[model samples]
Target: MKVLPIFLLLFYMALDGLHAKELPSNGNDEVIFPITELQIYADERGFVNFSDVLNGEVEFVISEDFQPKDYSVDSYYWIRFPLHLNNIESKQWLIEFYDQTIDVIEAYIPTLDGSYKKITMGDHYPFYQKSFDHKNFEIQIDPKLHGEIVYYFRVKSHTYADIRIAVRSINRFIEYSLFEYFLYGLFYGMIFIIILYNLLMFIAIREVKYLYYTFYIFSVGLYATCVDGIAYQYLWPNSPQWNQIAHGVFLFSLIFWAMVFGHRFLNVKNSAPRLHKAIWAVIFARVLLFIYAIVFDNSLFEYRNIEILPLSLIFYTGVYVLVRGYRPARFFVMAYGLLFLGFLIKALLNISVIPFSIVSYYSLHICFLMEMLFLSYALSDRVRILKSNRDRAMQRIILQHKENVKLKDKVNRELERLVDKRTTEIQEKNIMLEEANQKLNQQTAEISKINSILDLDNWKLKNNIKEILQDRLINKNLTLEEFNKIFPDEVSCFRFLDRLKWENGYSCSKCANTKYNDGQQKYSRRCTRCGYDESVTSNTVFHKIKFPIEKAFYILYLTNNRQNKYTLDELSEMLSLRRNTVWNFKKKIEQAFSDKEDSHLIITDLFSYHINKKVS
Candidate 1:
């Protein structure tokens, strides 16, 4: 049995020595493996001792897929590989885990004496706790292995288990770090410029929408930095704990501000109330995720699960609003479409739905650059449109002003012609009025002579005759005998009054009917249409007079003849009536004539003649 064991050990040693001569390398500067060739064992309970892996007690399975793909599991993973250094002259080599977000990593390298050299490095621990002082999880392999030496890695994470390992020479890693940082700096510099420009726009325009976009851009830039591992190397090198959670925090912030930007830019609340509510729902989910990140120390695993929900909802609602005919959404849709494509590519890669490549790794930043430039163009386009509208409005106002000026000039010309025509008419009327005044003076002189030749009673009777002539007795100077001939009785006097009142034919006061019947009273009439009784004097000054019609007409004639020219006592003495009775009769006639001067030509001309006579 001892000879068999010794022969087996010698056979294994010779086979391992032959395998060591074919150590993978390309020109010896660095060896870039397409995939990590390792035997992996998953410890589902997460409590498997490292001794079990070293003692060969645990069963190991070879990984078929070496490409970086997400593995969501609660188990700890053990990865074993062999480092053959016999073919390479230099023994100094660096083993680096490319992914920055992995929580805990433990490396176990076999020593010549069959013991293991262990090193712990991951984002979960402080920078001082790492095996190497580098941004990524790096470990410098011991330079003493002469044959095929086995290496082990125990990996665990609260986030995605997406591991990509690389082994490079020290000088090559330094060159790679410088070049990678340069590219990262260039990317961030572009983002910073966009942020600064938009911030200035926000200040200049004082629009909350621009401010929201600025914050969105800033959060996206920072999140991209975190995702690319630049933030861990430079921004927070010492705080590995912060570096671990930075991705989740910045991602949540990016989505939060993106929703805010959409809300203001789209005016969704006013334009689409239902869609606005959906946006709020997405925002609420983002808030809950943000709270989960802050409150739960190890919430990164949960955050990664629903990381795309907020942006997906925002994109969906944005397209809906655009389809609803919001004009401002035109450019927004184009710009966000590119951004969403970038996000889709990255998210697909993150979930292992797509393979990793240069396109998948840097496509988001490229799309970010495109989005920023496009959005800037969109803003400039909006400004151009606003300026065009303002200029058009100004042109319309100027045109309106010119039209008003032309209209005013035309009105002025017409007014000048009208003024000239009116002036000529006034001059002709003045000449006619002067000639009429001379004739009136001559008539007054004749009337004075006639008055002087007559006695006081005849003069008074003549004045009463003048009043009657000036009334319905047009153009006729009549004596008392002639008046008696025309209005010989009370029935004739009342009939004359009725004819004067209804010269246009009788009409009902209420119904406005033309036909009427003879009423009971002498001056009364009844509407045939409505059977309503109406007296000629019903709405006149003699409406309820107890005096006889002839006497009432006489009294009115005396009152009209006297007017303001004589006192009530003088008129009463002339008419042989009481002072109170004459005064009351005078008031009734004056009241009847009030406001009727335009329609009643008899009273209007009589009053005008009296006024002219007094003025002359």
Candidate 2:
């Protein structure tokens, strides 16, 4: 059995060697083959068959007699070759040939008409110059290959030669096409997610920072896709107009985002003035470049070159600010650094210093993604810092509130002390006022008692004078002098009585009635009120009392002014009577005056007058 396998292997090697050296021939500027019929068969018996000439027939025909007689051998050779295989594990095959005399031989494969390959031939005897055209080829079997498989072969006029070529070009095209599609889908998907995420952030934060970041991410995505040729080849194949415009759009967007993001990230206003000025200059340059691109389309390349200058300027400025401990500057430096590296790599590739391949094409986009991730972290850090600042402000407010509360408490206590002091002072003043009022009331009562006593004494004296006048009137012949002598203790009383008798009514005693009153001799009443009366004694003690009538009328006044024992002795001398008789008359008059003072009528009238005066 082993010998059988060895003999089969040797036979296979010899057949392969023979096939390797076989070459098709052309006659009369045309090529022909000895075997014309070809067929392929396969069955379930694990066997495959290729029959080029059925029934061992070598019957083939070539009609080359119609060729022009002047045609050269190089001009007329034409051939068709068909290849088929069964039970073939390889998707590609090789054909070989050799030629001895011809310095150059051309072979053509019709199945792969649009394809070209070079073949070399080796020297062999009989000057066996071989040429391959359509006539010498035949299909023996159709080989089964997966995925866009086709069969084609080349022939050469050589004794031995080797052909090495791929027979499945269709599969490679399909694989590359799918791979590029996948990359495009993946890139766009990431861009979509970035847009959605940034949109959400903008809504939640209501911050222009988020808006700038969104545009930055969109510009980055466009730049990456354009650099990769994905946008031109797959996304918009027929829109060359869009492709040309995309370049300027991408550049403009990039610069705009850089300017906006730089301002937000660096807090340019708070930075050093020179640094801030430099940043503004970069922004101005970007604007000039954008405007230049719009006004002059041919300046787009110049704009792109100018953009790099500003980018570098912004990047270094941001680095400076960041190193100076500007909080936002740190994020800007990191993000711009990533973008700058990406752009640097892409620029180098575009200038052809670097090979155009997958790694070079995707390097910039990957860097951009890294930049975005870093920026997100920076934004999160900024949010944390803002929150911390807000919390500190709130704490300050709370502290201020606490201080206000303490101040209010102190003020309230002070006000309460003032109120208490004021209340105590008012209470003390009220007590003092009450004591003063009590003293005033007691003084007023004592004054009222003294006035009542004086009024009662006055009334009693008046009544006593009136009683003496009535006694004299009853004794019609009694002269004023006699009456005064009898009642010397009441001399004023006697004078007042004489005046009452002379006058119809009481009159002034100091100025006596004169003129007609003195001339009247009739015994009619005569005074200021009436004419003078002859019965009225002008020099009698009654008319000429030592004291005034008002003072002398009161008994207490007489007693208080006169000497002791004068009531009776003085009255007897003035009246011309005995001392005992004068004494008895004086005593009786004093008793009547004292008795009248104690009467209820006098006391009641004095009290009533005092009460009426108080009411009025």
Candidate 3:
């Protein structure tokens, strides 16, 4: 609809008085008109081409509204302003464009002979291409060479560009340029000074908050340079593409550091932890938007108003913390308050709510300076409050120490009197206690010697029984009860698998990592390198078998025999399992180890050798 484009145009109408000048329709012999201020009047000629204007097919609506046209990348704006060069004798005249960030400007200068001279100028071109080596585009006018002429300028930019143009004499332009550059020097110099001071403070105190503020201030200065075209003129004159997105990049940096610094300085993590988390979320969103602007659509960077969210959030946090009686946030609140006022003033100027002036136009820059100063004060003020509290704490500790010393002296006097009386009795009791301890030690030594002999016998019995049970498992067909002696339950079977699977060494199948710790599950090793959790039964013939592992071991022991000792129905009865399920697993065991006749491989060998085969 018409609403969207109209809104963009209105929002981006940066400044007034860009242009429209036309030739007085006088004959070629002599063309002149009376003028006092030497300013050209223009009309907004929308979407018309140079050919149409040259052929006299277009009618110009001469009005004061014909200022520097707000830029929309989709449409071209032509300013048709008439120039009346009357009584031109010696004073030199030139057209100067105030907005240096216009992407393109096609200026058509007319001559007395009904012909025009075309000159191309814009920030899109190299800085050296401009006739004047200044931030604003300027074209010298030869007034004596032509009588009457109309000037047409085609203005377009990627973002909002101030379209204000002023016709100044050569001397006047020089004076204005010098004064402007001087102010720029002061502005940027102050920013540089602030950055240096904060850097030193960061080093001296080792507080990261100062460092964050320094970066934020640096970003603000860089964004200001991008906005005023000083960066394009001086820093990267040869790189026109960088000039287009410089403002956007620095603006994002400014907001990013502002959020971080505000979060730290306000101690949001301690005071408002929920909002502290919200700050990180907003920061993540801003990063995503910035990346999308850079990679997918750079024009999205022109949506500078999106910054209002973070700025308002920071301002609200400052106010909220201040309301909660945070002393340091007072100055922080004031700083952002004035900064928002600057944004508001600039917005008002864009909407024509406020009259245009240098201060109003440069409101943001002025506010940035004030905000930096107040924030620095806030940092120092926070330190002051902390130091004051620490000193009070030290004073309290000293008073408490004196009281503790007096009590210690009184207690020491009473203790000395009590110790004298008990000393002789304590010595006599200690002598008696030593004699009893000696006798007790002699009895304890004899008892310990007897106990060690019994422990040795107990260990020998347990080892021999284990060896016998293991031998019985290999030699004879194990009944379910006998199998329980070797693989008593699922846990015993799992331990056998755990030891049998990694008898050589552990290695991860996924990453080939050879190191591991215990996993969350029992009998499972977690690989240290790849974090792969491998269970004991993984990749084994018994994997996913529904019955208990001890039953499976019993079935395997029966199957490992030259003939299966137990019939499928017998195993179903003994293990309380289905006949078909027992038969299926008996066949799997047979296929895994049926290579040799009367093979007597131990139950542990079955797990290691046939481990690669999985249950289908």
Candidate 4:
């Protein structure tokens, strides 16, 4: 029980030693102190008033360790630093937080009237709202160090709470900022050169890869500027909200364009399909984190936590490219390695894992510059490789074209030889075809002569039959040629028909009257006794015949002589009449001879009643 009490006393003593921190007291006009030497207490609810801390109601514990603080917490952190000055006169002092992204900073300083004068400064407020017109958060302290001088800082942030506090003389602040800005100027100059160079390349080549890389470089450069206080100082001095989220916006943009550059630079889609898909997944993750940051404006640190997985995957993408024999990734890996080292050292320094120093503080900038230089070299090398590949492709095309020309020449020669052979064979076949055609024509002419002789013999046989069977008037059996010569026209045929029908005089069929006068119609006659009218064809087999009279006479002559039994087609052709007219006239002639049935009437006998009658 006595041993446990001794251990408890020792533990309490150790705790006291850890919480005690004292500033150096010297009669100096200017001095600087880091945040490590301060006492800190986190006010979870921020309900503790300054009066409570001053009235011993709340105790201030020492800050975590003698290093920088770089972690995010929801609670408000109250940092107390004890200042000891041995001067009786009032001296100028400054307390500044080097990190620019802190959201709110409240400083409680003890005044001569035994009360605290509060000063607020942060990027969350406008740059002009800061107590001093400086890029970083700072408060001026002019105090007489007689009894006790303590400064309380209430710090809050949406991102990493990098509690990098610096107490300095006013003059020291000016000198430090000048040096810092100078380094920033150099860093930005290099980035500008790279951006301009690549932009020109993009314009000259019109390559999408160069364009993507140009934007990636611009985003990275903008992100670096935002991380530093230069953007807040100069770019948008009045825009506190933009200053607050600028880091997240540029960071997400950098991530997106960097992945796009990687995908194009590595030719991943064509070379490594699976890796290309993984790159897209990383890009999607970046977008989600960006969206989350926008939704929860105060949860940027939480968004960063989600971003780690994709960032790690992006690193692994470089490794995958290297393993897959991607040539560009050699430089890619080197550049990323340097960048990773710089960011790691800076992170370690911010978290107090490594002591804060000038080199460690600007490690990210140094690494970024080196990375940009190496990447520019890599892009140049990529252009060289592409040009070389293009030249080789052109050479291959030219060689293939030459071979095609040779093959085409060989094919043309073979086609010419084949054409000559085909021509000779065609000529021989044409000569043999000509001989066969001549023999066929000779046989055709001989058959034509034999056909003509057979037709003449048939005609002579028809005449012989006509002489033996028909009347003597048509017994001469005029051929179609002789009939056409004797009665070549309609008038001659009409005269012949009149002589055949009314050889003695005109007659009327209605009353068997012999005497007739001229009727109104040219071929009609009117009877003087009975007033009956008659025409040359009105009462004969030719009655009501609308065809030419010459064709009727030839049909009668052919029928009387029995030279030929004409079908409608044959009669129409022989008499030059329509088939229907010939059929009708033949029907009327056959009907006229119907009373003499079974008595084969000759053409003259069939119409003798009309021809021989004289009613006078």
Cand. 2 TM to true fold: 0.42
Off by over 4 Å in 2: 1-180, 233-235, 270-273, 294-299, 302-305, 349-360, 425-616
- Which sections of candidate 3 miss by over 4 Å? 1-47, 63-73, 86-89, 111-114, 351-355, 404-616
lDDT of 1 by residue, 185-242 (tens): 7888888888898899889989777788889889988898788766766688788877
TM-score of each: 0.64, 0.42, 0.60, 0.57
Number of backbone collisions per candidate: 0, 20, 9, 0
**lDDT (Cα atoms) of all candidates against the true structure:** 0.71, 0.50, 0.76, 0.70
Candidate 3 has an lDDT of: 0.76
Best by TM-score: 1
Give the TM-score comparing model 3 with the true structure, all chains together: 0.60
In the range 390-496, model 2's lDDT, one tens digit per residue, is 99999999999999999999999999999999999999999999999999999999999999999999888766665554433332333335423433444434443
Worst-scoring 10-residue span by lDDT in model 2: 132-141
Q: Predictions ranked by lDDT, top down?
A: 3, 1, 4, 2
How would you encode candidate 3's per-residue C-alpha lDDT over 380-415 as one tens digit per residue? Answer: 899899999999999999999999999999999999
Candidate 1 segments exceeding 4 Å error: 1-28, 34-36, 65-72, 86-92, 110-114, 131-133, 296-301, 305-307, 417-616
RMSD of 1: 17.8
